[model samples]
Target: MANVTKLRCNETVRIEQARIVALYAQLGQQAAERLMASAIEDLAMHMVAIDAAVQKNQLGAFDDAVTSLIPLARQVGMTKLEQVTRDLRDCMRAQDLVASRAVLARLMRIGDRSLSEVWDLEDMSI
Candidate 1:
């Protein structure tokens, strides 16, 4: 019998504080909060779409959902999430399923954490 160890991927995510601050300044706190909530909701939905698409081997759907996510992530300052999204997209472009799958899993982890942090920080200065 062999001992099996589980690995956890806790990727470091970078959020752009200045960017978020500017958003609050430009839109006013209420409007910015509304917008941020909407964007976060959309990002979560897209992650679900991407996961389902990947499971079904529907790359086109995955592309559509992921492409939409990059700008949304950038809008609210999820820079690391944006970069990981691109990395996964690049892997897909190269037609390397192995790497693409690996990156996809990483993307989901980063995306989940980034969204949560953003939502949690909505009430305070980041």
Candidate 2:
């Protein structure tokens, strides 16, 4: 398997962290920030376990971690961030169906069209 680090990627993690920071700003300077700080403390506390699950290929455990982040993202009103987290969770839950079988059909159709165009070109000596 590819490195677990490739799963979230630095960009996604940065977006997640930025969403948390934006939530902090939206919640105000002191009191709400303190509350979110506490939550971050909790997430940090569990980080090792979450990372371990990801590294060990424990899909359920990894989903649990991604799931845990959603409420926190929602609390901050980071809807897109929340959606991305949910997508990751759903992919883990669905496994094989993550891409859905229909995409294969679509690609095949596209390939067939391209091949047909090639045949026509040959016939035209183009």
Candidate 3:
């Protein structure tokens, strides 16, 4: 019997806490909270679009969704989410279905983690 090792494909998802704190400092707590809430809502919609595009194998739509997600991800300090989205975009642009699918799976995982982290931060006052 050939010995096989399982490879863990999950990437570590993290939010840039300092950037979020800086936003709060610059914009005041109430305004920063509002902006974060809006960004989170927008990101959720984009995630849905990305999932639909991937399901339909629509590369252009997938690319577009990722493109829209990048700035929002960055603004909210979703570092891993932004990086995975970029990777997914590159795969879609190359027309690599297998690679794109892999990246899409990673993106979904990171997106969920990122949202949870943001929610945790939202519950805390800076």
Best by TM-score: 1
Candidate 1 residue pairs that clash: none
Identify the candidate with maximal lDDT. Answer: 3
Better of 2 and 3 by TM-score: 3
Q: List candidate 1 segments past 4 Å from native.
A: none
Give each prediction's root-mean-square deviation over alpha carbons.
1.4, 18.5, 2.0
Cα lDDT tens digits, model 2, 83-115, are 554554555457644342333233233323433
TM-score of 1: 0.92
Model 1 score (lDDT)? 0.87
TM-score of each: 0.92, 0.44, 0.88
Of models 1 and 2, which has the larger TM-score? 1
Per-residue error for 120 in candidate 2, Å, reads 58
Ranking the candidates on lDDT from highest down gives 3, 1, 2
Ranking by TM-score: 1, 3, 2
TM-score of 3: 0.88
Candidate 2 global TM-score = 0.44
